[model samples]
Target: RTLLSARAPVTLISTSGDPPLHIAAERPSAAATLATLIDAGAPLAMRDGRRQTALHIAARAGNSVAVATLLGARCDPELRDRWHRTALHWAVVNGQLGAATLLVAAGATVNGVPMPIKKHLKKTSLPLEAPLHSAARLNPASGAQMIELLLRAKADPNLRDQFGQTAMQVAQGAGWSPAQLSLAWEQQYVHGLDYLRAGSNHSR
Candidate 1:
Protein backbone atom coordinates (compact mmCIF):
# COMPACT_ATOMS: atom_id res chain seq x y z
CA ARG A 1 0.00 0.00 0.00
CA THR A 2 2.72 2.42 0.93
CA LEU A 3 4.72 1.48 -2.15
CA LEU A 4 1.73 2.02 -4.38
CA SER A 5 1.14 5.38 -2.69
CA ALA A 6 4.77 6.24 -3.37
CA ARG A 7 4.28 5.40 -7.05
CA ALA A 8 6.82 2.57 -6.93
CA PRO A 9 7.18 0.56 -10.06
CA VAL A 10 5.40 -2.73 -9.51
CA THR A 11 6.70 -4.24 -12.72
CA LEU A 12 10.39 -3.98 -11.94
CA ILE A 13 12.26 -7.28 -12.31
CA SER A 14 14.56 -8.61 -9.62
CA THR A 15 18.00 -10.13 -10.12
CA SER A 16 16.34 -13.55 -9.83
CA GLY A 17 14.10 -12.65 -12.77
CA ASP A 18 10.89 -12.17 -10.82
CA PRO A 19 8.75 -9.08 -10.56
CA PRO A 20 6.78 -8.11 -7.44
CA LEU A 21 3.67 -9.70 -8.83
CA HIS A 22 5.47 -12.92 -9.63
CA ILE A 23 6.98 -13.09 -6.17
CA ALA A 24 3.64 -12.38 -4.57
CA ALA A 25 2.00 -15.17 -6.56
CA GLU A 26 4.53 -17.76 -5.36
CA ARG A 27 3.55 -17.56 -1.72
CA PRO A 28 0.78 -19.61 -0.10
CA SER A 29 -1.02 -16.45 0.96
CA ALA A 30 -0.91 -15.24 -2.60
CA ALA A 31 -4.54 -14.41 -3.16
CA ALA A 32 -4.78 -11.40 -0.83
CA THR A 33 -1.45 -9.98 -1.90
CA LEU A 34 -2.27 -10.54 -5.52
CA ALA A 35 -5.58 -8.78 -5.05
CA THR A 36 -3.79 -5.85 -3.50
CA LEU A 37 -1.40 -5.65 -6.39
CA ILE A 38 -4.21 -5.88 -8.90
CA ASP A 39 -6.17 -3.21 -7.08
CA ALA A 40 -3.11 -0.99 -7.03
CA GLY A 41 -2.91 -1.18 -10.83
CA ALA A 42 -0.15 -3.72 -11.10
CA PRO A 43 0.27 -5.00 -14.62
CA LEU A 44 -1.12 -8.49 -14.52
CA ALA A 45 0.33 -9.33 -17.92
CA MET A 46 3.85 -8.10 -17.32
CA ARG A 47 6.42 -10.77 -18.10
CA ASP A 48 9.67 -11.12 -16.23
CA GLY A 49 13.04 -11.56 -17.90
CA ARG A 50 12.18 -15.21 -18.38
CA ARG A 51 8.93 -14.15 -20.05
CA GLN A 52 6.94 -15.74 -17.26
CA THR A 53 3.89 -13.85 -16.08
CA ALA A 54 2.59 -13.85 -12.50
CA LEU A 55 0.04 -16.44 -13.59
CA HIS A 56 2.84 -18.71 -14.69
CA ILE A 57 4.57 -18.38 -11.32
CA ALA A 58 1.33 -18.97 -9.46
CA ALA A 59 0.48 -22.04 -11.49
CA ARG A 60 3.97 -23.48 -11.06
CA ALA A 61 3.74 -22.97 -7.31
CA GLY A 62 0.36 -24.77 -7.24
CA ASN A 63 -1.33 -21.67 -5.87
CA SER A 64 -4.83 -22.18 -7.22
CA VAL A 65 -6.30 -19.14 -5.47
CA ALA A 66 -3.66 -16.92 -6.98
CA VAL A 67 -4.23 -18.51 -10.35
CA ALA A 68 -7.93 -17.86 -10.04
CA THR A 69 -7.32 -14.29 -8.99
CA LEU A 70 -5.06 -13.71 -11.95
CA LEU A 71 -7.62 -15.28 -14.27
CA GLY A 72 -10.31 -13.04 -12.87
CA ALA A 73 -8.04 -10.10 -13.59
CA ARG A 74 -8.04 -11.15 -17.26
CA CYS A 75 -4.55 -12.53 -17.45
CA ASP A 76 -4.02 -14.57 -20.57
CA PRO A 77 -3.91 -18.18 -19.48
CA GLU A 78 -2.62 -19.12 -22.92
CA LEU A 79 0.36 -16.78 -22.80
CA ARG A 80 3.54 -18.76 -23.22
CA ASP A 81 6.89 -18.10 -21.60
CA ARG A 82 10.27 -18.27 -23.27
CA TRP A 83 9.90 -22.03 -23.41
CA HIS A 84 6.49 -21.57 -25.04
CA ARG A 85 4.82 -23.24 -22.06
CA THR A 86 1.59 -21.79 -20.71
CA ALA A 87 0.31 -21.63 -17.15
CA LEU A 88 -1.63 -24.83 -17.72
CA HIS A 89 1.54 -26.53 -18.88
CA TRP A 90 3.38 -25.37 -15.75
CA ALA A 91 0.54 -26.54 -13.51
CA VAL A 92 0.47 -29.99 -15.00
CA VAL A 93 4.25 -30.28 -15.05
CA ASN A 94 4.37 -29.39 -11.38
CA GLY A 95 1.48 -31.76 -10.48
CA GLN A 96 -0.64 -28.79 -9.43
CA LEU A 97 -3.99 -30.52 -9.91
CA GLY A 98 -6.14 -27.76 -8.41
CA ALA A 99 -4.42 -25.13 -10.51
CA ALA A 100 -4.78 -27.34 -13.56
CA THR A 101 -8.48 -27.77 -12.86
CA LEU A 102 -8.96 -24.02 -12.54
CA LEU A 103 -7.08 -23.40 -15.76
CA VAL A 104 -9.08 -26.05 -17.62
CA ALA A 105 -12.36 -24.67 -16.33
CA ALA A 106 -11.26 -21.21 -17.45
CA GLY A 107 -10.97 -22.60 -21.00
CA ALA A 108 -7.24 -22.89 -21.17
CA THR A 109 -6.15 -25.04 -24.09
CA VAL A 110 -5.97 -28.66 -22.96
CA ASN A 111 -3.57 -29.63 -25.70
CA GLY A 112 -1.58 -26.49 -26.38
CA VAL A 113 1.50 -27.43 -28.40
CA PRO A 114 4.84 -26.38 -26.93
CA MET A 115 7.40 -24.60 -29.04
CA PRO A 116 10.70 -26.42 -29.23
CA ILE A 117 13.57 -24.92 -27.25
CA LYS A 118 17.14 -25.40 -28.36
CA LYS A 119 19.48 -27.05 -25.90
CA HIS A 120 23.22 -27.67 -26.07
CA LEU A 121 23.64 -26.99 -29.76
CA LYS A 122 21.68 -24.66 -31.98
CA LYS A 123 21.73 -27.35 -34.67
CA THR A 124 20.22 -29.92 -32.34
CA SER A 125 16.46 -29.64 -32.45
CA LEU A 126 14.45 -30.53 -29.37
CA PRO A 127 11.05 -32.14 -29.52
CA LEU A 128 8.08 -30.13 -28.34
CA GLU A 129 5.10 -31.78 -26.64
CA ALA A 130 1.76 -30.90 -25.08
CA PRO A 131 0.71 -30.27 -21.47
CA LEU A 132 -0.34 -33.88 -21.02
CA HIS A 133 3.02 -35.05 -22.30
CA SER A 134 4.75 -32.90 -19.70
CA ALA A 135 2.48 -34.27 -16.98
CA ALA A 136 3.21 -37.81 -18.02
CA ARG A 137 6.95 -37.38 -18.31
CA LEU A 138 7.47 -35.13 -15.31
CA ASN A 139 4.69 -35.81 -12.80
CA PRO A 140 4.47 -39.57 -12.67
CA ALA A 141 2.67 -39.79 -9.33
CA SER A 142 -0.26 -37.73 -10.56
CA GLY A 143 0.11 -38.47 -14.25
CA ALA A 144 -2.96 -40.71 -14.47
CA GLN A 145 -5.32 -38.19 -12.87
CA MET A 146 -3.78 -35.35 -14.86
CA ILE A 147 -4.18 -37.24 -18.09
CA GLU A 148 -7.77 -38.08 -17.21
CA LEU A 149 -8.58 -34.44 -16.49
CA LEU A 150 -7.04 -33.39 -19.80
CA LEU A 151 -8.85 -36.14 -21.68
CA ARG A 152 -12.15 -35.06 -20.19
CA ALA A 153 -11.40 -31.56 -21.37
CA LYS A 154 -11.34 -32.96 -24.91
CA ALA A 155 -7.60 -33.08 -25.19
CA ASP A 156 -6.50 -35.36 -28.01
CA PRO A 157 -4.78 -38.28 -26.37
CA ASN A 158 -3.32 -39.49 -29.64
CA LEU A 159 -1.83 -36.18 -30.67
CA ARG A 160 1.82 -36.67 -31.49
CA ASP A 161 4.61 -34.39 -30.39
CA GLN A 162 7.48 -33.15 -32.48
CA PHE A 163 9.22 -36.42 -31.67
CA GLY A 164 6.25 -38.26 -33.17
CA GLN A 165 5.38 -39.67 -29.76
CA THR A 166 2.05 -39.47 -28.01
CA ALA A 167 1.65 -38.78 -24.27
CA MET A 168 1.16 -42.45 -23.55
CA GLN A 169 4.22 -43.33 -25.57
CA VAL A 170 6.23 -40.74 -23.71
CA ALA A 171 4.98 -42.17 -20.44
CA GLN A 172 6.02 -45.61 -21.51
CA GLY A 173 9.49 -44.47 -22.48
CA ALA A 174 9.74 -42.49 -19.26
CA GLY A 175 9.88 -45.78 -17.34
CA TRP A 176 6.18 -46.34 -16.67
CA SER A 177 6.00 -50.13 -16.80
CA PRO A 178 3.70 -51.87 -19.27
CA ALA A 179 1.28 -52.79 -16.50
CA GLN A 180 1.05 -49.22 -15.26
CA LEU A 181 0.46 -47.88 -18.72
CA SER A 182 -2.20 -50.44 -19.44
CA LEU A 183 -4.01 -49.76 -16.17
CA ALA A 184 -4.00 -46.00 -16.73
CA TRP A 185 -5.23 -46.34 -20.28
CA GLU A 186 -7.92 -48.83 -19.35
CA GLN A 187 -9.18 -46.61 -16.55
CA GLN A 188 -9.42 -43.55 -18.81
CA TYR A 189 -11.00 -45.57 -21.63
CA VAL A 190 -13.60 -47.14 -19.37
CA HIS A 191 -14.51 -43.80 -17.85
CA GLY A 192 -14.87 -42.23 -21.29
CA LEU A 193 -16.90 -45.16 -22.54
CA ASP A 194 -19.23 -44.91 -19.55
CA TYR A 195 -19.69 -41.20 -20.18
CA LEU A 196 -20.57 -41.84 -23.80
CA ARG A 197 -23.02 -44.55 -22.85
CA ALA A 198 -24.68 -42.27 -20.33
CA GLY A 199 -24.99 -39.52 -22.92
CA SER A 200 -26.45 -41.96 -25.43
CA ASN A 201 -29.00 -43.23 -22.92
CA HIS A 202 -29.98 -39.69 -22.03
CA SER A 203 -30.62 -38.94 -25.70
CA ARG A 204 -32.92 -41.91 -26.05
Candidate 2:
Protein backbone atom coordinates (compact mmCIF):
# COMPACT_ATOMS: atom_id res chain seq x y z
CA ARG A 1 0.00 0.00 0.00
CA THR A 2 2.75 2.43 0.94
CA LEU A 3 4.59 1.71 -2.29
CA LEU A 4 1.45 2.28 -4.33
CA SER A 5 0.57 5.43 -2.40
CA ALA A 6 4.09 6.72 -2.94
CA ARG A 7 3.62 6.06 -6.67
CA ALA A 8 6.88 4.19 -6.89
CA PRO A 9 7.73 2.49 -10.14
CA VAL A 10 6.51 -1.08 -9.98
CA THR A 11 8.58 -2.08 -12.98
CA LEU A 12 11.86 -0.81 -11.64
CA ILE A 13 14.61 -3.40 -12.06
CA SER A 14 16.80 -4.26 -9.10
CA THR A 15 20.58 -4.55 -9.30
CA SER A 16 19.84 -8.27 -9.82
CA GLY A 17 17.71 -7.21 -12.81
CA ASP A 18 14.40 -8.53 -11.48
CA PRO A 19 11.38 -6.23 -11.33
CA PRO A 20 9.00 -6.04 -8.35
CA LEU A 21 6.50 -8.25 -10.16
CA HIS A 22 9.09 -11.02 -10.63
CA ILE A 23 10.07 -10.85 -6.97
CA ALA A 24 6.44 -10.93 -5.89
CA ALA A 25 5.78 -13.96 -8.07
CA GLU A 26 8.61 -15.80 -6.31
CA ARG A 27 6.79 -15.53 -2.96
CA PRO A 28 3.52 -17.32 -2.30
CA SER A 29 2.45 -14.84 0.41
CA ALA A 30 3.05 -11.94 -1.97
CA ALA A 31 0.42 -13.08 -4.50
CA ALA A 32 -2.06 -10.34 -3.61
CA THR A 33 0.73 -7.79 -3.82
CA LEU A 34 1.54 -9.19 -7.26
CA ALA A 35 -2.03 -8.55 -8.32
CA THR A 36 -1.82 -5.05 -6.92
CA LEU A 37 1.39 -4.43 -8.83
CA ILE A 38 -0.21 -5.72 -12.02
CA ASP A 39 -3.11 -3.34 -11.52
CA ALA A 40 -0.56 -0.58 -10.92
CA GLY A 41 0.70 -1.33 -14.43
CA ALA A 42 3.61 -3.64 -13.75
CA PRO A 43 4.82 -4.97 -17.08
CA LEU A 44 3.78 -8.62 -17.18
CA ALA A 45 6.14 -9.22 -20.06
CA MET A 46 9.14 -7.93 -18.14
CA ARG A 47 11.96 -10.49 -18.10
CA ASP A 48 14.61 -11.00 -15.49
CA GLY A 49 18.38 -11.32 -15.94
CA ARG A 50 17.85 -14.77 -17.43
CA ARG A 51 15.01 -13.55 -19.65
CA GLN A 52 12.41 -15.31 -17.51
CA THR A 53 9.00 -13.73 -17.14
CA ALA A 54 7.35 -13.46 -13.73
CA LEU A 55 5.13 -16.41 -14.61
CA HIS A 56 8.21 -18.65 -14.96
CA ILE A 57 9.46 -17.54 -11.56
CA ALA A 58 6.07 -18.22 -9.94
CA ALA A 59 5.73 -21.69 -11.45
CA ARG A 60 9.32 -22.71 -10.67
CA ALA A 61 8.86 -21.50 -7.09
CA GLY A 62 5.75 -23.69 -6.81
CA ASN A 63 3.92 -20.56 -5.74
CA SER A 64 0.48 -21.71 -6.86
CA VAL A 65 -1.24 -18.61 -5.50
CA ALA A 66 1.07 -16.39 -7.49
CA VAL A 67 0.59 -18.59 -10.54
CA ALA A 68 -3.19 -18.35 -10.14
CA THR A 69 -3.07 -14.58 -9.66
CA LEU A 70 -0.90 -14.15 -12.74
CA LEU A 71 -3.12 -16.46 -14.79
CA GLY A 72 -6.18 -14.50 -13.67
CA ALA A 73 -4.44 -11.39 -14.93
CA ARG A 74 -4.09 -13.17 -18.32
CA CYS A 75 -0.31 -13.25 -18.34
CA ASP A 76 1.28 -15.28 -21.12
CA PRO A 77 1.61 -18.77 -19.73
CA GLU A 78 3.31 -19.82 -22.96
CA LEU A 79 6.25 -17.41 -22.61
CA ARG A 80 9.65 -19.16 -22.74
CA ASP A 81 12.85 -18.25 -20.96
CA ARG A 82 16.44 -18.08 -22.21
CA TRP A 83 16.47 -21.86 -22.33
CA HIS A 84 13.32 -21.85 -24.46
CA ARG A 85 11.20 -23.65 -21.87
CA THR A 86 7.69 -22.64 -20.89
CA ALA A 87 6.38 -22.12 -17.35
CA LEU A 88 4.75 -25.55 -17.58
CA HIS A 89 8.18 -27.01 -18.26
CA TRP A 90 9.54 -25.51 -15.06
CA ALA A 91 6.49 -26.58 -13.06
CA VAL A 92 6.80 -30.23 -14.07
CA VAL A 93 10.59 -30.24 -13.71
CA ASN A 94 10.25 -29.00 -10.13
CA GLY A 95 7.27 -31.27 -9.35
CA GLN A 96 5.09 -28.25 -8.73
CA LEU A 97 1.78 -30.01 -9.22
CA GLY A 98 -0.48 -27.12 -8.26
CA ALA A 99 1.29 -24.68 -10.52
CA ALA A 100 1.26 -27.17 -13.36
CA THR A 101 -2.45 -27.80 -12.82
CA LEU A 102 -3.25 -24.09 -12.96
CA LEU A 103 -1.22 -23.63 -16.15
CA VAL A 104 -2.84 -26.63 -17.81
CA ALA A 105 -6.28 -25.36 -16.80
CA ALA A 106 -5.45 -21.98 -18.28
CA GLY A 107 -4.79 -23.73 -21.64
CA ALA A 108 -1.02 -24.18 -21.51
CA THR A 109 -0.05 -26.81 -24.05
CA VAL A 110 0.47 -30.24 -22.53
CA ASN A 111 2.33 -31.51 -25.56
CA GLY A 112 4.80 -28.63 -25.72
CA VAL A 113 7.49 -29.18 -28.35
CA PRO A 114 11.14 -29.17 -27.39
CA MET A 115 13.66 -26.77 -28.83
CA PRO A 116 16.09 -28.26 -31.34
CA ILE A 117 19.22 -29.60 -29.75
CA LYS A 118 22.21 -27.52 -30.77
CA LYS A 119 25.77 -28.80 -30.95
CA HIS A 120 28.29 -27.83 -28.25
CA LEU A 121 25.57 -26.55 -25.90
CA LYS A 122 26.53 -25.23 -22.49
CA LYS A 123 26.40 -27.79 -19.66
CA THR A 124 23.92 -25.59 -17.80
CA SER A 125 21.48 -25.52 -20.70
CA LEU A 126 18.08 -26.86 -19.72
CA PRO A 127 16.68 -29.50 -22.04
CA LEU A 128 13.36 -28.26 -23.37
CA GLU A 129 10.95 -31.19 -23.66
CA ALA A 130 7.25 -31.91 -23.56
CA PRO A 131 5.75 -31.68 -20.08
CA LEU A 132 5.00 -35.42 -20.33
CA HIS A 133 8.69 -36.12 -20.93
CA SER A 134 9.63 -34.22 -17.80
CA ALA A 135 6.95 -36.05 -15.83
CA ALA A 136 8.20 -39.37 -17.20
CA ARG A 137 11.82 -38.69 -16.28
CA LEU A 138 10.80 -37.96 -12.69
CA ASN A 139 10.75 -40.64 -9.99
CA PRO A 140 8.24 -43.17 -11.17
CA ALA A 141 6.26 -43.30 -7.93
CA SER A 142 6.01 -39.51 -7.63
CA GLY A 143 5.68 -38.83 -11.37
CA ALA A 144 2.81 -41.27 -11.80
CA GLN A 145 0.26 -38.77 -10.57
CA MET A 146 1.66 -36.00 -12.77
CA ILE A 147 1.67 -38.33 -15.76
CA GLU A 148 -1.94 -39.27 -15.03
CA LEU A 149 -2.89 -35.62 -14.78
CA LEU A 150 -1.27 -34.75 -18.09
CA LEU A 151 -2.74 -37.81 -19.72
CA ARG A 152 -6.15 -36.86 -18.41
CA ALA A 153 -5.58 -33.39 -19.79
CA LYS A 154 -5.12 -35.02 -23.22
CA ALA A 155 -1.32 -34.91 -23.47
CA ASP A 156 -0.06 -37.04 -26.33
CA PRO A 157 1.50 -40.15 -24.92
CA ASN A 158 3.03 -40.74 -28.32
CA LEU A 159 4.83 -37.39 -28.57
CA ARG A 160 8.58 -37.84 -29.02
CA ASP A 161 11.33 -35.95 -27.27
CA GLN A 162 14.54 -34.56 -28.73
CA PHE A 163 15.93 -38.09 -28.60
CA GLY A 164 12.92 -39.27 -30.56
CA GLN A 165 11.64 -41.34 -27.64
CA THR A 166 7.98 -41.39 -26.65
CA ALA A 167 6.96 -40.52 -23.09
CA MET A 168 6.09 -44.16 -22.33
CA GLN A 169 9.48 -45.21 -23.67
CA VAL A 170 11.10 -42.58 -21.50
CA ALA A 171 9.12 -43.80 -18.49
CA GLN A 172 10.21 -47.35 -19.17
CA GLY A 173 13.83 -46.33 -19.47
CA ALA A 174 13.44 -44.36 -16.27
CA GLY A 175 12.54 -47.68 -14.57
CA TRP A 176 8.78 -47.58 -14.46
CA SER A 177 7.24 -51.04 -13.83
CA PRO A 178 5.28 -52.77 -16.52
CA ALA A 179 2.15 -52.53 -14.39
CA GLN A 180 2.59 -48.77 -13.90
CA LEU A 181 3.16 -48.21 -17.60
CA SER A 182 0.11 -50.31 -18.39
CA LEU A 183 -2.03 -48.21 -16.06
CA ALA A 184 -0.85 -44.98 -17.66
CA TRP A 185 -1.64 -46.29 -21.12
CA GLU A 186 -5.11 -47.30 -19.98
CA GLN A 187 -5.74 -43.91 -18.46
CA GLN A 188 -4.59 -42.19 -21.61
CA TYR A 189 -6.85 -44.38 -23.68
CA VAL A 190 -9.91 -43.50 -21.63
CA HIS A 191 -9.26 -39.76 -21.34
CA GLY A 192 -8.30 -39.46 -25.02
CA LEU A 193 -11.76 -40.71 -25.96
CA ASP A 194 -13.35 -38.12 -23.72
CA TYR A 195 -11.30 -35.39 -25.36
CA LEU A 196 -12.31 -36.59 -28.81
CA ARG A 197 -15.96 -36.64 -27.70
CA ALA A 198 -15.70 -33.13 -26.38
CA GLY A 199 -14.19 -31.91 -29.63
CA SER A 200 -16.81 -33.71 -31.70
CA ASN A 201 -19.68 -32.21 -29.66
CA HIS A 202 -18.20 -28.73 -30.00
CA SER A 203 -18.08 -29.16 -33.78
CA ARG A 204 -21.69 -30.35 -33.98
Which ten contiguous residues of candidate 2 have the minimum total lDDT? 119-128
Error of 2 at 116 (Å): 3.8
| CA error at residue 8 for candidate 1, angstroms | 1.5
Clashing pairs in 1: none
- Which ranges of candidate 2 are over 4 A from the true structure? 119-124, 190-204
Score every model by TM-score.
Answer: 0.82, 0.84
Using TM-score, give the best candidate's number. Answer: 2
Candidate 1 Cα deviation (angstroms), residue 153: 0.5
Instruction: Report how far residue 69 has shifted in candidate 2, in Å.
Output: 0.5
**Clashes within 3 Å, all models in order:** 0, 0
| Local distance difference test, each candidate | 0.79, 0.81
- Can you write out model 1's per-residue Cα lDDT over 67-100, one digit (the tens) per residue? 9899999999988877777899999888999999
